[model samples]
Target: VGAGGETAHLAYNSGASTQHSPLEDENDYEESDAGSAIGQLVNGTNVLAIHGLNAGATSSDFHIEPQLIITTRTGGGGQTGYFATATPGAPNGRPETLRLPQTVTFSRSPGPFTGSFQLSITGAAAGQQIRYVMASPGGPFNADVPAPTLTSTLYTGPVTVNSSRLIRAAVFNPSNGQGGEPSTAQYLLLETGSGNNTSSFTSPLPIAVIDQHGGGGYGPGEPYKTSFLHFFNRGPGDIARLNAIPDVFTRISHKVRGSSSAHFPKRAYGMKTRNDQGENKKFELGGLAKANNWVWYNPWKYDDAYVRNAFMFQLSRDMGHWASRNQPAEMFLNVNGGKLDSNDYWGIYVLTEKIESGKDRLDIESIGSSDIAGDNLTGGYILKIDRADEDETAWQTPTAQAGSEDRIVVVEPEQEDEKPEQIAYIKNYIAGFETAVLADRAGNWATRNYQKYIDVPSWIDVHMLNSFALNPDSFRLSSYFHKDRNQKLKAGPIWDFDRGLNADVDSGAQYDPRQWNGTHFDMSWWKQVWRDPEFIQGWVDRWWELRGGALSDANLNQIITTMGD
Candidate 1:
């Protein structure tokens, strides 16, 4: 467990062991250029890049691949192949330069509901074992201590890789734990022998990297860069119920030594009646006052915002993208380091309803910034990982993509060509930007009554929701990100004020529409929450699950825990 299957984006650890164990100690110090490699495809991949460089030596010693950090593996046998790097001081280093490949991507596995990818080492014969593992930033990691042993000694055939959305794969030689070359060479993936249809064709997954907007040159990279740091740093905060503080922090955080800081509040977000209490101030996390009062989102407890954002983090983790929730923090020396970006906003948390009706699951969409109603929860955003470092925003409207004005979060059609349209409608609905399309869907839902299924559709329609889009069950997660409707009295799942502050109408002032009729995130959101039981239940159950002991003492002591993870 020496830092294997972990991140290196952590701040300099005050308690890092002086002992240099290959598996534990050394692995913790590696790093990568995964963040830069994100290109236009996955701008939120900044976190992955930050981590790749941090895990240097251990990546080579134990062959422990950093889960989600970007490091592609490709070889011609007997020789290592080249990959992008981020090593500081090296040529093309510190963000993306030529380096060695440490991990392997999985080929798309073809399954009915779910899928998988397989790997193997090259030129290896049957019965010869090779160790491999797979993990995702959005998910968990799994390693093969007992490397896969090839039963067939002969080539049998070519190799095929499967590309699934669940996670990425990596292959390495484990030496059978016996420390000797086996009778034959082993392939890194299973597609060559018995797995593929004929082991002759190589079919990669038609991968789709979607909606990670904070960095894609389309949206703000500030908050997203901060999010990347915390996601990898905080690890996963698991929550179960309401009135309970969510443990937003996790084992992934790293604390800096001796950094004294001050507090200054500029503006208030995600609360009732936005205010500029000067309550938002900058202070060293180490010196911040402890929460004498119980926090609703304890670092130990996980909630829907936690889970939804967790999924987005995993996506960026695998893709080696960079993103964070807060502004990048600096040491007391006036020198900023470790993870975190500016304005303390990570990537937005996407919340989709799992509409189940007699064993059927439907699709719906929402964001970390949406307003919520119901009982346990009122109107406010959830699972937001604002960077404690940066405290400013340069907000603006979403890029003009087609269908940016639809408001009916619809279940993504199970057909091709229909996807873009479906997603467009959802984004508008989630943002509470419009309700025309939504009203069109369930037939004048403003005063409708529900007789079947659940209230998800109704809730969305009733509340002025907001989001980019929705899609699901497709080869990629984007298929699950668009809009759809459900049954409910008032629309909700609303919270988050960053998008409305001063730039646009929606976030600036809830009722005033100065710029072409804008949207607001405050009272307008809660106006519906007072009548919805469904909204209350979601928060109630979540807070109920994050009780005692599920949390560790180490987790409870910090203002943030991601830098160390």
Candidate 2:
């Protein structure tokens, strides 16, 4: 068989070619311009071999699909041929093999012994084909054997296999040769006695643990500590289990996230999947696309309804902007070795894309080298109007901007390593713009407008989003501004909005759109620019124009409904 699955008959130097099979070359599969492997038919058999190829160690576990075979030809005069497999075996089979559940944990209720109770089902699909396999590890039962193995109970309905302390039950997909991870090694005594009927069976969202044993617990201002995080999602074949799902080797640090909601019970974390040491491994959580670094956002303010941030982010994208991508997740902490202590329910959170300079993320230049100069030093910078933590190195504006107390922080480029000239360049550029804004004369105001320093349309869109959503801390804090070297400063990729969408503000009743002016919050320079009659009219004109399109009620309503689903 050639790399493209075309069979070629090559003259064998001897009489009958040795009978070969695809499985023989399975591990040795190699890629060419033609595909992965190439082979030729030998005497009565197909043998596959790569020319001068080194079959190095591969992590691939190729599960051949199940197939039925019928003899195409029978022995005749000097001829005996059988039908050969036409295609490479499919891994896990046609619909894909099912995987054993990653976690199975049983907890018995302490209520009065009742021989009657329901073992509830949550994740099970209504009509999906599923079966239960109960096995005792290191005992008389094994999952590797054929069905009806001794001491193992294979049932089509909900199981009551708690008789043996070590009986592990997993959802089995016989057709796909996959089974979920067996439940933990212990049995739950639902009732105090052997004859008591099994009561409740609840499938809680799988627990995830971020063990920061080296650094104790995470804090608002803490150094990055080496951490191991493991979270499970139901897949591989419809079974969910612990540790059997995704795993991430990360360096985690808890930097306070959100504006006012930073004080909420749940804290946001900044996780670096690839730290200074360059650990590039990544995992997909909640079935979201894969990425190395992530922000585990706890939307504490929104409580169980954690869609605010995801909603806001989707709105930004629909309005033709690049915003953080988010997925709702059930976050838990510190469950190691089947023990859940010092753990937290942590509740629902928005697992979001961490704002950074990367292809999938901010998509800006990454000027990380210490010796960076010229265009390299100009940007790929992620500057923000966020409150500076103690560890953050920042530059204070020479003249205080009105209404805002916090300083702008240079979030990217690790300030300590930034060249003095590079640091001075951005500082002076911002300062020069501020000076020009403050010194704008009536006639020259348009030419010297803050518009020259920023992407006016983006700023307008961001303002409209904040205004429409009535977010209290919109322009001032948790606000992000970035530029890519030669590009003008663009507003947002918007952040934290748990406080948006009619959420109450702790300071006051500031959710009213009329009361909250985008200009009045912070960046006093905005107030000076707002005074210019031309800029004000442009802001209003641009806003109303967008209201007819992206911000239109119909468009927004559709976006809300689609995203909610």
Candidate 3:
């Protein structure tokens, strides 16, 4: 096929059959086919299509290029000429080409330094000039935007950089007023001979630099403040790449978040990525799933190892269940909204995915306001058993015993988004499950079997993980349950285990591994299921299966070693 939709046919035989063929003598073949005569040229848009039949085998390679030849008939002879480059199966080319200005380059790469140094900028062509801007770390400059309007200084000679700051530079054409994209580099100054003081920011993990634009310190309640977030890390196996450029930078609404951990010195934060207009924007940060909502988990003082929560989540995912994905990161929080320095370093934190209803998260169906009946009303709900917050809306199971104040709170379908019928459906579903559990314990397994209402494997896995970790808060606080449309209730994607693994130093009883951890707190559904012999056997069988595999001594040691390194 020619570039202008002209077609021709060339005969060849593929080496597929063992039968004798006319072209069998030749091992390599190349043939030229002349396209059909060209028609009068037109000025408007045109398209061409190329078609072929089994061009080659799966392991073979094939490519084709088509060209259009124009002929001018003179008085005596015809003159053949080639036009512009052939664009087979593509649109015609424009008369002129557009080019961007050259990018600006820095003499020194971003990194930590001990003293002031002379920095030079280059990479601008003769017709282009270099413009630059300097600001404190996590300042107002953003290099990702094109043709940003800023108070920039013209580059003439080397400049002295004495402190930690960010530098952004770009090339611009003076005649056309066109500017190329900008380049950014960060410089961090450190004290010489300092050990522990400087080592905090030089971590092997990724660094999260947050700037609140000189806002007040974050509070533990409503009204999240607008902030800027920048994440830096070179990638896997690149240990301590403190000079690496940021892999992610975006606007976020940041606020202090936690139930009991909110009072800690190093507070955890809940953030949602947003755009310049303050609308929700999803980002794939730290290699986790893309979601707007995220959490920066602050390990409690008892968890000196700082791997309790991460380990638990990893183990849960290894057991074929979905859990909140997280990555270890060091944070530099500029709440006062000035230059980021050693004092702004907030130490280690886990950048975690928030539990919600999404394909990458819980992988459940979403229920809309109109879906208040039939199979739609039966599912895609996330419920928690944590302490109720003021102004929170939740419902209590009808089968609750006297003095039992455990109210199930809906985590998804925000209270305002949930309909009355949908709430009633999930509420009654839990009540029925509770009633069946009590009835099944009384030898009514034939009909009122509790297993029929819940996913047995998921329940067993959740039970074994919490029990093995000796999490005192299991089955009560921060406990989660989720159900999908037309699917039975399932437990898990466990959360908030900083006090787990015998790390609760304040209480001796809770720290003891031998004691049943769930018993330390008020019993809920698991309490009733323990009386069922079937459930007991299932739990015991699952324990042995995991002990021989994922929970084996050698496997556990390997996992711990890998995480520590």
Candidate 4:
């Protein structure tokens, strides 16, 4: 497809020379800063679909999902080595020729994407090599967005970049598919890093951003865990700004875990600190995070199909992949509307090294689910949490059932038939969803309570995997095969991790499918090691900011009822 190409060029120092990209599509999005609106993709879902032929015409792209089109043509049966040919507009894939540009650059998200965001010069001959660079704000950004180059005319501004998302596309043209100064001006969304607003994706940050607290992580007494950019590697300490709307919305998603985390808190307790405004104090609210609420990524582990999105989610969350790191100041409502702070609205802001070792956890808090609710600006639902336990025999099940307050275990009620596309709809909701990175667990780390022989903090286990969402696995890995926090057995803390859905049937080592990817909730260790409190939770309260005050039970009920029969 005359679109994107390879991904993940994380080295900030290696300085690979400019390269070229011919993409299948140059998909750039303008995300809504309010509750989820129509037209925009959510929950990492794709917004583009392969357009089909007219009623009279009989073409394949119109009949099936675009992903299937790529599969049939590329992998097993019909392998057409072409660019953007199989995109929505064409089934047998349309063939187009356009004017070529002199210089080009094709950057991409660190992990994965649906279409190629490649910037390129069309009409170049087969041999001509257009110089381009596929840059990312984050080192791990190798998402599905293919590579391409920017137009020479637009490459006028000075390419300024110190951290991730600070990008510029410099490409030298060689061969065009056809040759000569072809037709068509360079696409706008996929253009060079020009103009004050032309910065597309975020780039990677320096390594030091992770250990701001001397490798202690964020938060007081809890070690490190309060940097808002823990997920993307930038924060107030680094970017020195925040976008009130986007920042709070993303943070809310991280806290709610997912749409399914909606429900009355079994109990709510203070975290020992207060918001700068002193309105929204820190606290741990307990409830179920429906099954399938895997939010955090298990990076470096690509074998599990369900967890394939681990790296993708990590990159996607950073939001700065191909954008300008120098952002303007902005403000929005906080729980304490009277008081507010400045913010940078670029994209996801991940911290470094702090949560890299996600395997650490404790008995109080098992591998916390990322069942993060989507930013509300787009009319999204509540939690779509990962399941922690299910389908266990009397002997095989863990001695403890899921819940914080009442150990009142209720066998899961038989679920009625689901409405059409319910799973797909819910899945779609989270794919484009971006979470926040705020909050710091004050009082003390889980170790504080455990060592002091204090009562189990209610926040320790607030999510409900069995009753709320569906677990793709036969049972919850964290529930049973669990151990204690000894011999360096770190107790886990909760963060904005997500579910573990495998890639589609068409997505493989080569041939790919899907418009967007789901959030990465899979853990680093598949063998139930994320229960460490110091490791996980320490980062949770701080990574993403919260959207609304608390997860409302009314919203949860409304969401459940939305699953029409």
After superposition on all C-alphas, the RMSD of every candidate to the true structure, in Å, is: 30.0, 16.5, 14.4, 28.1
Assess every candidate by TM-score: 0.20, 0.59, 0.65, 0.20
Question: How would you encode candidate 4's per-residue C-alpha lDDT over 1-565 as one tens digit per residue?
Answer: 1112223352323321333333345443212232233335365435543222222333223222233122123555532333422255643432223333433323322211222344333322345544333333222321111233434333333343222231223333333332122121111121223332212333333211111111121121221122111122235545422211122111111121112322212111111112321223322211111121112212212222322222322222232111101111111112111111111122221211211111221112221123222321111111211242232111111222222221211111101322223324333322211110000123333233232221122222222221122222212332222112212112222222223334222235223345233111332121121244553563355233211212235433443353221
Give the lowest summed-lDDT range of ten residues in model 2: 141-150
Clashes of 3: 0
Look at candidate 2 and tell me the lDDT of residue 388. 76
Ordered list by TM-score, greatest first: 3, 2, 1, 4
Whole-model lDDT values for every prediction? 0.24, 0.54, 0.71, 0.24
Kindly list the per-residue Cα lDDT of model 2 for residues 151-212, writing each as its tens digit: 34544444453332223344444454444443322222233333422232112343344543
Instruction: Report residue 471 deviation for candidate 2 (angstroms).
Output: 1.3
**Per-residue lDDT of 404 in model 4:** 23
Indicate whether candidate 1 or candidate 3 has the larger lDDT: 3
Task: Report the lDDT tens digits of candidate 1 across residue range 1-565.
Answer: 1232443344543222233445555447554334553454643332323222233444343333544544556564333334332345743322222222333322322111112324333432344333333221122221101212223222223343332212212232333222122211111111223432211221111100111112221122222111111111111242122111212211111111100111111111111111111122221121212211111111111122233333332222222222112211111100122111122222222212222111112222322222222321221111111122223211111421112222122322322223333334334334343232223233534442322312344333222212211111011111112222342222222323222212222233434455323222122223233244554465344334322322223433322245324
lDDT of 3 by residue, 235-332 (tens): 66665444445577666889888877788898889999986446799988878889999999998677878888888888888778888988988888
In terms of lDDT, the poorest run of 10 residues in model 4 is 432-441
Model 1 ranges with Cα > 4 A deviation: 1-82, 85-423, 427-565
Task: Please name the candidate that would achieve the greatest TM-score relative to the true structure.
Answer: 3
Positional deviation of residue 536's Cα in model 3 after best superposition, in angstroms: 1.0
- The superposed Cα distance between candidate 4 and the true structure at residue 240, in angstroms, equals 22
